[model samples]
Target: MGIDGVVFGCLTPNNWLDEEALDRLIEAAEGLQITFHMAFDQIPTTQQFEAIDWLSEHGIHRILTHGGPRNTAINENLEQLRKLVNYANQRLTILPGGGVTVDNAEELAKQINVNEVHGTKIISLPEENND
Candidate 1:
């Protein structure tokens, strides 16, 4: 079964994924993109930086995070997000998500100086019908 890649979420938190599981995933996803989603924020900041280096070393393609705490506006964590983005410069991709919306994605991305942006709010999804 050949799939484009895998998104780590809707399952367990990123920290919940032990090294064995991550290695297995990395091995199984060779030649494909393996994204570590927002759960990155669940880990302590100090550990998160170490994890960033480790993830990059292990070939994790990208990571989605809110930078500080979950549900906090991206603006509040701009400094932290910028640091993460800069640290991940060529090692891996850091995608700022969570409170990001289309209205602010541009400014955030610009300030963070990242080419890629994440979060569902960027796209306008149609409302559901009540019928």
Candidate 2:
């Protein structure tokens, strides 16, 4: 296989990164770009900055996040997302997702100062129910 990258994440029951599990994934994904998925949002907000430092030190390439509780809309979470992008400081990519749509993607990225965004509606509408 010629896959270029992988997205994965793991958290302990207490809402911390399960470094043991992540180590396994990292080893398996060696030589490929690795993105820690939205599970980043599951960690306690107070601990998130530390998590970013940890993930960056471990060579994670990106973080996909909604910037807050998943139930909230992405627009409502822009401030937090902005903080995350700023804190990342290019140490790793902070990808804002959830409720992101093509219609709003440009402004959203500009607001958060991120170069990328992610969501089901990021590019175009589904033809039918393809999702």
Candidate 3:
């Protein structure tokens, strides 16, 4: 498939991520990259850290996270989120997503110390479309 990496999606504590699945995922990604995505509301910070650590132990380096609701502006609690991101970045690539927009994307990037912040509104419209 010429795949660069394998990503495990919709990971949660309630789901039975058996050894077979983990083994297969690892075998398939033996010489490639591996990442996992977790919805922000699905797990708590402690569990998130544990998952990240587990992935690191298995040589996985990329970790993606949903940033929860848009109503919960990251800017409002930048300090807390920044601390969490900083901690997680030490072990994995913490990609924050969900409810992101151009208005707060740059600020989130800066606060989280990430060069790129994923958002639906990060792209700039053509100048001609401004009208």
Taking every candidate in turn, the Cα RMSD to the unseen true structure, in Å, is 4.1, 3.4, 3.5
Clashing pairs in 2: none
Q: How well does each candidate superpose onto the true structure, as a TM-score?
A: 0.83, 0.93, 0.70
* Worst-scoring 10-residue span by lDDT in model 1: 9-18
Instruction: State the lDDT of candidate 1 residue by residue for 49-73, as single tens digits.
Output: 7888878998888899889887677
Candidate 3 local distance difference test against the native: 0.63
Residue ranges of candidate 1 with Cα displaced over 4 Å? 9-17, 124-131
lDDT of 2 by residue, 12-122 (tens): 999999999999999899999999999999999899999999999999999999999999989999888998999999999999988999899999999989888888877
Residue 64 displacement in candidate 2 (angstroms): 0.3
lDDT of 3 by residue, 40-89 (tens): 33555546556556667777766666544346665654554565577676
Off by over 4 Å in 2: 125-131
Q: How close is candidate 3 to the true structure, as a TM-score?
A: 0.70
Per-model lDDT: 0.82, 0.93, 0.63
Off by over 4 Å in 3: 10-20, 67-80, 127-131
List clash counts for every candidate, in order.
0, 0, 0
Candidate 2: residue 59 lDDT (0-100)? 90
Quote the lDDT for 66 in model 3: 55
